[model samples]
Target: MVDVLEAGGWGLLAGSALLLGAVLGYTLRIPHQVVASVMAFGAGVLLSAVSFELALEAYDRSGMLPLVLGTVAGAAAYTAGNVLLARRGARHRKRSGQVRGRSQPSEGQQAGSGLALALGALLDGVPESAVIGLGTAEGGAVSAVTVAAVFISNVPEGLSSSAGMRGAGRGKGYVFGLWGSIAAASMVAAAVGSAVAGALPASAVAAVTAVAAGAILTMVADTMIPEAFEEAHQAVGLIVVAGFLVSFALSRA
Candidate 1:
């Protein structure tokens, strides 16, 4: 119970960034380049965490088979969900409604996009938060690197998505409500992850961890990187590398 509470707290702490970003996006007029740069950095951080913390840890725990199978399964699952959501007008859920060469979504497209965007955010966030609980179940301190990575990444997610929502004509109430619900859900996800991982065997835990890594990696490649490079161009690579190095150093430390 105590561990679960701790996991919830950490998950909320991480997830809270989404609300903060939403507030910023709704209130302020941030530049696309800035948003792109931050998104790239967050993507890099998540990539590093997936590589060093999740996939490697899973490999160390139960060897190669579980890791490979779990990762493939996770990637496939996320891809399928993404496809379904895309068809519902969430294909550009991560955009700020202002793609460089693309026109904004029409009223008909925006009509159903709010729900799809919210669901898409949930899909991206749950697995990441679950891994926090999984870390806690390992009998020591929770992984700070994981928490930090998720927090950093979530800020841009909320910022960009909320900005897009606003562009799509969503009201402030809707924007805040959407992010608030997701934040609360993240807390529940972390607690549930802790509880479930606590009951699972080592091999099972390894598989689950690998699954999250795979999904996150796919998200980065499909959603984050393209958005990051959309505006920032060459410099986004440097920022990504810097973010990756920072996360890698934290993991090593």
Candidate 2:
């Protein structure tokens, strides 16, 4: 119980990025290029975490078959969920703020619903938070780099998404409340992950981890990179490389 609580606390700490980003979006008029650059950098950090921390670990433990299957399922799950949300008017779930002001009013309504941001945050955050707990289950501290990667990635997610939603007419209170709930959910996921770590077999761990990797990779490829390029243009590639190298170095440390 204590361990679970500790994991939950850490998850809360990490999840705070969402609220922080939302605050920035609500309070500041961030430039378009800055949003794009940050998104690109966050994508790079997330890529490193997925590649080295989640994908490699899953491959090592569960072999290729399980990892592949899990990856497929994870991607499918996120894609389906995104499609459903898009249909419901949250098409800007992963969109950068620069282009979002052009949406129709009805589309704004959907964005204001806040469901898209919440779901998107969960799709990305839960898995990483679970990994934190999984580390604790191994009788060790959570990887500092993993936390950094997740936290940093989440900031852009919150910032960009919040900007879009705010442009769509969502209230500051609504955005703050949405990110706050996400933070709480993250805490729950972390605690539950660690609590169940002892019961889950290594195969289960690997498959789940692979699921996260797949989902994150799909999200980055499908949404993040595209959005970054849309705004940041050529410089995003270098920033991506820089972000990846930095996260990679942290992982190595």
Candidate 3:
């Protein structure tokens, strides 16, 4: 139990690095195009990591059914969660009479965006934290790799999250709220990881890989890439590719 707590604490601390990034993003005065490029690059790296490292390795270590099923399960879980949130968000907007008309974002729209970002993080964090906790419990070379991959993938995610908040024009309160919620998700993940240690170790890694990949891909293609183009000219595409390569290198390292 003590070990589990310690692992959870570590996982939460690591996840909180994301929040720190959000605060730093406030100071950096990041351009929208830059954010897009970074997000795209990060997405590429995440995709590569999930495909080459997490998914492939898990299958190698375990077998076909567990790997495939786990991957599908992870994707399904993410889809279901997002679908539910979309419905809820729509309803929330409808109730408040807020989401009507053009998407130019009226004054309070930012608040909605902040809430949306927080909601997304909360949904994503559980499995992530769980993976970290399980890695720590394993306590060996494998643990090191798992922790490192998760840590790497998390950096861009944190920064991108903050970027989302800023883009939405969320105030400091919302910024902190989003960050706090994401941190809490890390803790949730840790709890889930602890619980799954014995029951479904092998499948968990594969599932997480798939889910993270899908989410990251959607975010880059849909949100970040578009934001980048909106902020600057087409020249930024090169920069975006460079960022992707940099992240890929780090992931490999």
RMSD of each: 1.9, 2.5, 5.5
- Cα misplacement distance, residue 97 of candidate 2 (Å): 9.1
Of the pair 2 and 3, which is ahead by TM-score? 2
Instruction: Return the lDDT, model 3, position 152.
Output: 49
In terms of TM-score, the best-performing candidate is 1
lDDT of 2: 0.81
User: Best-fitting candidate, measured by lDDT?
Assistant: 1
TM-score preference between candidates 1 and 3, better one? 1
TM-scores, one per candidate: 0.93, 0.90, 0.70
Best-to-worst order by lDDT is: 1, 2, 3
lDDT of 2 by residue, 1-253 (tens): 8888888888888899988988887778888788889889988988998899888988998799889988998899889877876776665443432254574445455474346766788877898788888877676578777788888888877886677677677788888988999988888888988999989988899888888888888888877888789779879999888889999999999
C-alpha lDDT (0 to 100) for residue 90 of candidate 1: 70
**lDDT of model number 1:** 0.83
Alpha-carbon deviation at 183 in model 1, angstroms: 1.0
Compared with the true structure, all predictions reach lDDT values of 0.83, 0.81, 0.56
Better of 1 and 2 by TM-score: 1
Worst 10 residues of 1 by lDDT: 91-100
Superposed model 1: Cα runs more than 4 Å off = 93-99, 108-114
Between which residue pairs do clashes occur in model 1?
none
